[model samples]
Target chain A: MTALPPPSAKKLGLVIDLDTCVGCHACVVSCKEWNSQSPLGAPLADLDAYGAAPEGTFLNRVHSFEVTREAGPPVVVHFPKSCLHCEDAPCVTVCPTGASYKRAEDGIVLVNEDICIGCGLCAWACPYGAREMDGAERVMKKCTLCVDRIYNETLPEPDRVPACVKSCPAGARHFGDLGDEDSAVSRLVAEREGFALMPDQGTKPVNRYLPPRPRDALPEFDVLAPYLEPVTEGAGGFLGWLDRTLGKI
Target chain B: MHPAPSLILFTVLSGLGFGLMVWLGFGALVPLGWVGFVFWALAYGLAGGGLLAATFHLGHPERAWRALSQWRTSWLSREGVLSIVTFAVMAPHAAGSVFLDRPLPVLGALGGGLALLTVFSTAMIYAQLRSVPRWHHWTTPAVFMLAALAGGGLLAGQVAAAGPLFALLAVALALHWHMGDRRFAAGPDTAESATGLGRIGKVRLLAPPHTGRNYLLREMVHVVGRKHAARLRLIALAAGAVVPAVLLVALPAGHLLGALAVLLHLAGMLAARWLFFAEAEHVVGLYYGRR
Candidate 1:
């Protein structure tokens, strides 16, 4: 009789700090570079290269938005969007084939690309729109959480991290064993408030975003600078020009 | 959600195939005895083949057996189990019709019920997917029932010698038409409400997340023009239901007209099934820049 493998502990996940992110897009580039050469096959690409509409492949994208505050300067929120690897992954369940499966040990959702027929049902099932079908390969592709790099035994212990986390210039991205209660990510979750995007769907996304700090402390003069610039320019220019032309001390 | 051509063909073709089987099998049950047994076998075989062909659309046909394991939670599993049961019932029924001296009416009735149940299970598979709001309605089951009733009725009218059965088929055609009309009328309002932003306000996509078209847009945002859909619906209703009804009424004069009606009804049913998928709007459509 064959013996079954021992059941593993809880699945580890990620918690990103959106508050400190400066939208450098280094994480996006790093994610593409790492996944492109992985065993899972490349999902990103450069399309219409050397043309007017050239674009490159990216698994993660940083989006910048200006949120107008009531009493301060507009807060610029930088959002990094990628797969959350939810517990109730619709993408996996809706698959007619067993190509998509959530890891029993880590809860990291992965695709067995070899078995995928590229029928695209998994893409439809995802509300977050995380999975993208590689038009060239004719298979669905998504963020793998840098599984290969994170677990590689050949690499030095300190260097063993997701490419996105390593490349984040602003220290916005953090990767650790979220399943462990005393891990850095878990402690960060406890110290700061974190929220999942579209929590109403109840997919139980693993990734979390720390809210941007309030902009109330900024000076009122700085807030009014853009609106008051024209009025100040008219007065200052005329007075300065008159003084300059007359050679007044 | 990205309507695979193979799947669309499978569902529509099988709907007609199984629908025809139900009518023929039921005919064999009611007083007709062994007269319509050959037609019943043909219908069952066609429906079985259509259902089997649908499995080709799956990624792993080897794992297809596993689908039957989840009948407790999945309608898809129920459909698979019911389809197999239908086939099992059909084999014995077909063997009896061809080989046995005496027709087994009880077996015929049981087979007929199983065939109908198979179709119901297939319909319920779609009807139960709450994520696809358009499919999760009474209309889904109603349409499947209508397809079976109409197709079966048309087949029965063609093969059976009994004139009263033709009148019964006429009633089924009328009911199919009525239900089809009602189904189409219950349009995209539920979808609008599900988004939680629209009652009477105009909502439009100002900017999409990306310039390149992705799977979500391709799958959910398929739009058919209203004018064309309306025209097709009318044609299908007339050819599938009204024309068949007229033929059934005229069957007393000549059986050839009944045969013509069956062909017309099949064509109409195919068109109607096409429109069924074409007109359906998934709630995911809202995310794909459609309101």
Candidate 2:
């Protein structure tokens, strides 16, 4: 079962706008809250819940970086990373137990906890660090794209996306069939030039991140005008200049 | 990239066991009568015990049998299947040699070949991982194969064969170290590429994903000091290859020399295996600016 199926026509994926993400960690929290109650890798236990240096498995994480250009104002780029649901997901192929697999219907990658030995090879195979080994549950955990929620008919249509996508306050996350050229997510990708995390790795990730648009230059300000005026005065000798500069200031 | 001690021991001990089995297959060091049992016992003990130790690393050892079901794609599954086949084939070969006091040449050769294949499969488990550039190279499996040959030769009491095998091991180890260090220094991937922020300028870590050490960082972000790693590499080379080769070539064939050589070589192999894991640079480390 680890042998990948032929590429599916409906490539369901997420497109994240890096420009609008505020590094609020809300998506991470929402993902945790929803998945902790799901069938697989449930009750994602924290080794030290209330103690110092709490550690646990998470399906998604936000990393903040300070990008400094030599001439422009520094900008903080917040990157939200998760399972890309790759066309050739290494995590799926490297699983020894056939527990990690990709759906042939919609290209959603998932882990079957029933057969997982939790040897941690899938996690090591992942270049994006999207897979997490849930030690307490004894299985590998990953972003399922909320298969349970998305397909559940009981939930209202507006509330039927992945928890992270539905809860994002900044509306940075978008989900739809990317295989459709005219889909909103596909159009966004086309317009914004969304990119994969490491294209050279050949994962061909379904999820994309739109880069932050280039910032405009700051407005001009005469910060030194008041201090410079007295030093250039007409009466200037060393002492006169010093007195004027001191008195004027 | 965390150098789990069990895995280091697993590769070293298993390689030594399977290597000795190869020698026994070729009648290179065939002991007669009752003594043959001790030899086969030691070989199977090291290989089987090492494999058992590896299972301890799994989160659910009870479900470890499920690992064999996915051999079509996974190197880990291939390793599992090959290990089982190697043991099944080698068992009868060991029985004929010990119980019948005779060598089954054809059967022994098949078992020996499978043993070698199992070792290659084990190496491929790491070699196939593109996520860790340090381990994803031809040199990884080559190094594993060479170490098995060299260590097996010494353990099988083939002093003459040990000399040349150890020499090849020395050259291979040096090349592996040189390439691994250079790759770490200037590989293609970087933090900028990881985040797709290279167009902006240099990217620096402003804030980590969390204040605490998460599972990803704990398992994949291990860092070793450059100076210490260099020193360890030298020690591994000397103890594993140079000293063993020199002793085997210059000294008389005696129990003391053989025992001393095997012990030192094992220590060296352990160090090298530890470095193999500890020094690996996982691509995920780029996100945390660990690269």
Candidate 3:
């Protein structure tokens, strides 16, 4: 059951834009709010919520990095990390119980909480650290891509996307079938040159992160004073020179 | 990795137990009377006790039986299945030797082969984890097998074979630990590669998502200081392999000396297993800028 299904024609995934993300934790919160109450990982455990070290299971997290470019200004890139839902997900394969599985229909990796023994092997197998152990429930939890919300007929079509994608204030997150080249997300990846987190790992992650755009150089101009110029010629006094110049003109 | 005490104990104890079973199956150094019964009990106790301890580490120990269902793809499941099979095969072999007063050569050979396979499967559990580069090596399995043979030989009263076995274990441990240390020192994956930010420049973590420890950090972001790690490595090598080899060579195979060698080797292997888990670097660490 852990063996991956044959390549699906429709690989549903997310595309995150690094250029547009402002590191505002809107998506992270929205994802928690929705999934915590949903069936995938209901009531995501929060240990010592009001204490010195409040720990909780989170499906999505935002990390900020300062990249010091060679001979260029250091760029602070806010990276949002989540489940890549790899095509060859090791987390799925390593599960001793058949609880962790990938959906052949869409390639979304999920854990069957009813069957999971909570051995913590799946978390160890995941390179992205996407899966977290829910302390109270004692089961592995991760991003479900808001499967409940995305598939619900009661909600409007616009609200059918993942909670993270909908709540992103910077419009950094995009969701669609990545397998189809003509899909919106796939086209965006093509145009933006999106890339996987660790291609060397060979996870074949479905999601892609579009790197930040190249920083532009400053233009040749004095920003402080564009109109002012020093007087070059005034042989006589200021008034005499002005009158002479007026007469000559 | 967190290097949980339960897991360290599990690998070390089970390795020693299964290793003894392998030697017994080959009819090596096995005594003719009450001593053989005692040795069988010791092997089973170590293997069974180690397995029991592993279940305690699980969040749902009551559901541990469910783990045996996915043997085809999962190394953990395969280990579970093979362990049970080894026990079944060895039990009959033990009964024949103890109750019937005859050694079942065929059964012993089968059980011994299965016992070694279980250890191999156990090693694969770590080695197959591509997430942890330190564990993802051939040396991991080699060290595991050597440790089993060395420690198990001492337990089985095969002091003559113990010398060479201990030497092999020392070499394997040294090679594995040295390589693992070098791998950690030379950062393979970086924050830049993790986030695809290398094209831009050198990426460093300015701030983590949270100030407090999260599940990921608690479970995967284990960092041991360089000085402490070096010191522990020396301890593991000296206690686990060197001391046992010296004792086995110096003293004849008496009850007192054999007991001392077995205890010392077990202690050493425990240290080695601890280091094995403590030093593993998970790729997720890159996101936290700790790789």
Candidate 4:
């Protein structure tokens, strides 16, 4: 059962725009907040709360890096990463138990905690570090793509999306069927030139990331230089007279 | 990767156990009656005990039986299935030797082949992981097989065979280390490639995702000190192979000397196995900028 299902046409995935992401960690917070209570999987572990080392599990995480470019001083890129739901998901095949599987219907990778032996081999097999082991429950937890919410009939149509996507304040995370070339997410990916992370890894990740847009360099002369420059040759009016008197003394 | 003591004991002990089984099945030295019982018992105790140790590291030890169902894709699963099959095939053969003092060559040979296959499958579990460049190589299996063979030879009292095997194992271990040490840099994956920021320029971690550590960091981002690793490698080679080889070749073969050699070899193997896990650099660490 760990063997991956035949390729599915519906590649339900996310497209993140790096240009718009501010690295606020709202998606991370939202993901943890929702998945913890969603009843879809085991609750994320939060060990040693309020102690010296507080540890917890989060499916989605936002990492900010300083990319040094030849033209600019340096670019700050906020990278929000999660499970890509890879077409050739190594995590799926490497699983000793049948718990790890990719959906033939949607191409979303999921871990069934009930059967998961939590050997941690799947986590090791994953190149992206998307899975986390819950300390208390001792089960592997990963981004479920909010399967509970996405299919819920009680919620409004607009609200039926991944928790991270719905809660992203910057509107950077877009979720849709990426396999359809005409889908909104796919169009955005095409227009923005979105790319998969570590393409050479051969995971063929369904989710894509839009590279940071080009930024203008700062002016060569400081804008505050004019204000700091002297208004007059010496001190203005009274200060000039006082200076002359002080010099005479 | 984080080298848990349970896993170390599992790999080292089980490998030694299975290695001894290989020689026993090949009709290396089958003692008569009760003596044969003790040898077979030792092999089972080490292998079975080591297997039990593996479950200690799992999150759900009770569900480990489920691991046997996925041999189609998983090497870990294959190892589980193959190990059970090896035991079943060899059990009767071992029983015959212990009770009747007659070794069944055909059944024992089949069981021996299965045992070696199980070890290979175990090696494949790590070697198949492309995420760890050092482990994802042909040398991984070679080193594993050589180590298992050498260790097994020592336990089986194949004194003449142990010396040559230890030498070969030493060379293989050194080669694995020498090649594996440079593999990370040689691989296409890097901090830049992982981030997909290489197109723009060089990438560096200005700040991590969180101030606190996560499971990934705890499990996969283990770093061993350079000097300490070097010292341990020398110790592993000396104690595991060199010393054992020298003992078996130079000194007259006696029970005490053989026991000392085996003990020293086990110690050396323990250190080498420790390094095998501790030194492996997972590609995932590039995201945290730790590897």
Model 4 C-alpha lDDT per residue in residues B75-178, reported as the tens digit of each score = 99999999999999999899999998778989999999999998899899999999999999988998888888888998899999989999999998999999
For model 1, residues A75-173, the per-residue Cα lDDT tens digits are: 555667778877766666655456677777777778777766665656655655577777566667888888887889988887688889989888988
How do the residues A119-202 of candidate 2 rate in per-residue lDDT, one tens digit apiece? 999999998999888857867889999998998899999989999999999999999999899999999999999988888788
For residues A126-235, write the lDDT of model 3, one tens digit per residue.
Answer: 98999998978888888887888888999999999999999999999999999999999999999999999888777899999998998898876877674565555455
Tens digit of per-residue lDDT, candidate 4, span A46-130 = 9998999998998998898999999868899999999999999999998988999999999999999999998999999999999
Using TM-score as the yardstick, the better of models 2 and 4 is: 4
So what's the TM-score on candidate 2? 0.94
Point out the worst 10-residue segment of candidate 3 chain B by lDDT. Answer: B181-190
Model 2 per-residue lDDT at B270 = 93
User: How many clashing residue pairs, candidate 3?
Assistant: 0
Q: Residue B64 lDDT in model 4?
A: 95
**Number of the top-ranking candidate, with lDDT as the measure:** 4
Cα lDDT over the full model 1? 0.63
DockQ-based class of model 3 = medium
Backbone clash pairs for candidate 4 read: none
TM-score of chain A of 1: 0.80
Which candidate leads in DockQ?
A: 4
- In candidate 2 the C-alpha lDDT for residue A188 amounts to 99
